[model samples]
Target chain A: MNFIAEIDVMPLKELLDPQGKAVAAGLKNLKLDAITDVRVGKHITLKLEAADKATATAQAELACQKLLTNRVIEYFTFEVKEA
Target chain B: MNFIAEIDVMPLKELLDPQGKAVAAGLKNLKLDAITDVRVGKHITLKLEAADKATATAQAELACQKLLTNRVIEYFTFEVKEA
Candidate 1:
């Protein structure tokens, strides 16, 4: 079976997101005032050939832990679906 | 009201994702062959002050258009929820 995993990796909220802060400041400069509290993260879409959804989920989680994220400063969540 | 917007920005499937290709090669080097067809993108969470969901969605869409994405090579989608 083929599955698609939509994974979100974000800096822990307690951590300062320099990118987000810079973007927020940039937007403010542009006079876009309605938006705030910006946090930037990675949206990774993985295509997995697995035996089942469980296996695909496990593979996605393993990828997240090993290659996709910096565990010390970031956390992740994902949704899996058929491709 | 405050609303949260979860935005996903990705390279159009028709476009080549060099980063994704590089990561896929690296994963293969690690002998993680079970995962394939990886696509990388951005996950942005924005907090917006709007009168209602409709307004929040509008603001988020505008931000995506103006700042968060490069429309020439990438495309985006988002979900907005009350926070």
Candidate 2:
């Protein structure tokens, strides 16, 4: 089975996002005055070929813990769907 | 108008993804032997409250350039849909 997973990695809320901040400031230039709290993060979509959902989830969790996140500065989770 | 945007940010291929590397190694524990090239990145879904579609795209792009990417190490783009 193949699963499609969407993952997000963001700095903790308490942490400052320089990129997000810069983005917010730039939006101000374009007259997007309604925009606020423009937090920025990364998104990744992966195709995981596993024998089953359990295996796929395990693979995803393992991926999150071992390679997908810094745990110290970032966090991640997946929305798994059949592919 | 409101827009839903999906964003992805990843390290340039030349930059090593330590977390991605660690994740690949961990998948080995799950018997996912076929899995390879498991690069990791972040995903963010944004709701841009704007007056029009063109404005929404510009806001989203500004968000990417000024906040979302670290040009030295990362890059990003968006998938915009009507909301």
Candidate 3:
């Protein structure tokens, strides 16, 4: 079976997100003041061949731990769906 | 009302995703061959002060068009939930 993983990798909340700050500043410049507290992160979609949803989710988790995330500075979450 | 927008900015399917490719190659290097067709994108969470969910969604959409996304090379989608 083939599955698709929709993953989000985000900077740890305790860590300062420079990119998000920059974007917030940019919003201020744009006069979009109603928008605030912007947090930026990475969204990833992975296609995997596995025996079932459980297997695919495990693979996705392993991939997140090993390659898709920087465990020290970032954390991730994901959902698996049929491709 | 306060809302949270979960937004994703993705490279157009037609465009070659160098970052995705690099990650895929890295996965191969790590011997995770089960994972394939990896696509990388940005995930943004915006806190917005709006009149309602519809207003929040509109603001999030505008933000995507103006700043969160590079329309020429990328596209975006988002959902707004109460914060």
Candidate 4:
């Protein structure tokens, strides 16, 4: 079976996101005052071969743990579906 | 009304994503060979004040066009909900 995974890796909310802060400031400068806050993260799309959805989900999780996120400052979530 | 927008900015499928290629290579090095391909993009979470859902969605779209994306190489999609 083939699967597609959409993964989102975000900074821990407890941590300060400098990039997000900068963007917020920029938006303010652009007069987008309605936009009060911004948080920036990574969106990753993966295409893979798996035996089943469960295997695909597990593989995606392992991939996130091993390569996609910094456990100390970031967390990740993902969903897998047939391609 | 307060709204939260989840925005996804993705590289155009026609373009080359060097970062994605690097990650794919790294995954292979880590022996996660079931993963066949990868594409990476930006995930942005925005908190904003608006009068209604339609207004919030319009604000998000404007923000994307004015600052968040370079239309020549990327495209964006978003969903807005009450915060």
lDDT of each: 0.89, 0.71, 0.91, 0.94
Per-prediction DockQ:
0.83, 0.30, 0.86, 0.86
Clash pairs detected, candidate 2: A19-B67, A42-B42, A42-B43, A43-B42, A43-B43, A66-B23, A67-B19, A67-B23
Candidate No. with top TM-score? 4
lDDT tens digits, residue span B1-83, model 1:
99999999999999999999987887777676778888888999999898899989988888899899999999999999999
- Among all windows of 10 consecutive residues in model 4 chain B, the one with the lowest summed lDDT is B54-63
TM-score leaderboard ranking: 4, 3, 1, 2
C-alpha lDDT of candidate 2 relative to the true structure: 0.71
Clashing pairs in model 3?
none
| Native contact fraction, candidates in order | 0.88, 0.36, 0.87, 0.81
lDDT of 4: 0.94
Clashing pairs in 4: none
Backbone clashes, each candidate: 0, 8, 0, 0
The most accurate candidate by lDDT is 4
Off by over 4 Å in 1: none
Native-referenced DockQ of model 2: 0.30
**Rank by DockQ, descending?**
3, 4, 1, 2
Between prediction 2 and prediction 4, the one with superior TM-score is: 4
In angstroms, how far off is A35's CA in candidate 3?
A: 0.8
Q: Candidate 3 — what's its lDDT?
A: 0.91
**Candidate 3 lDDT by residue in tens digits, B5-71:** 9999999999999999998898888877778889999999999998888888888888898899999
| Chain A TM-score across all models, in listed order | 0.95, 0.93, 0.95, 0.95
Badly placed stretches (over 4 Å) of model 2 are: B1-42, B45-83
